[model samples]
Target: MLETGATGPSAIVLNGGSSSGKSSLALALQSELPGSWLRLGIDDFIDALPPRLVGAGGFEVEADGAVTIGPAFTALEQQWQAGVGAMARHGAHLIIEDNFVSGVAAQKRWRKALEGVTTAWIGVRCTPVVAAEREARRGDRIAGMAARQALIVHEGIEYDFTVDTTNADPTTLARSIAHRLAR
Candidate 1:
């Protein structure tokens, strides 16, 4: 049975752009926070998408690292977000990984979905240049995406707190979030 309304925060939203170390931070946070926390992010959903919808049906990825979501992609994203909300409602502690590309609108959607759940929003910030460097080193992300999203992703969401990975390591950043959760 899912345990609803347990003590402390039941969900954490890590909002940042690609290559900002959100994934690493999530992992570090899992190690820092007590109990089990689930990670749900755009990557998870994107990976699950059918090949037909990956780059054309619902989403587009330009060579310059720009991404556009079509109507179909938007529809799928809604379902994914809803499911994450359901998981929270069922008492699972969630670590949501996202880039609020639509700015405030996207954050508002998540806020509404998680209205009754105790959710902590975290802004993961990294200077575009630094993020680009990280991206190049990682070798998995599309080039230039980090620079493209570094600023726009955090546009209008107010975070419980923000973490800068530009100089800090994931473990250090994770501890800060853990401290917030402890309070």
Candidate 2:
């Protein structure tokens, strides 16, 4: 069998909901892990999208905190994921944080994109109530978004391990994850 790269995981995919400390975890993981990992996430991808697709004829952040995406947004998202996976394939270390609203189907898509690339899956968990509170406190996020995604994002998708962001801070969580995965 052909050997994979010797530098450990090419990518670490962190799945979680809004306000779930995923971004925070990614930042800490960069410090904890032994690599210059490039962080590409759902929000970063969305922010880079064209304004037209951000709301009209694209993805919308609803008043109730629910998110809706159209075909255009999905198309771009697929391309974006593939691009990130390609980067990993070419030897870039990646930290990806995506909310898998479509559950296993979303994971399958990522698997297809990441073919032949070593990857680690992490489920970043937080209680809906706690996420909701964080979302409200952040003020930059839409209301109820945390509650809408907290549990839904984890459905039908399994991870190599899970981390609870309900109480543990990002640095602590990343340290724990790094130590566990390092073993």
Which number leads on TM-score? 2
Model 1: how far residue 149 lies from native, Å:
0.4
Per-prediction count of colliding residue pairs? Answer: 0, 0
Model 1 alpha-carbon miss at residue 35, Å: 1.0
RMSD (CA, Å), each prediction: 3.3, 2.4
lDDT of 2 by residue, 1-183 (tens): 112255568888999999998999999999999869898899898889998888967989899988888889888888988999899989899999999876887898898888888888899999999999999899999898999999999988878889999999899999998786665
TM-score of 2: 0.93
| Clashes by residue pair, model 1 | none
Model 1 segments beyond 4 Å from truth?
Answer: 1-6
Candidate 1 local lDDT, residue 54: 76
* TM-score attained by model 1: 0.93
Summarize candidate 1's per-residue lDDT along 22-141 as a digit string, tens digits. 999999999999899998888998998877787875877789999887778877888888888988999798899999877887888788778788888889999999999999998988
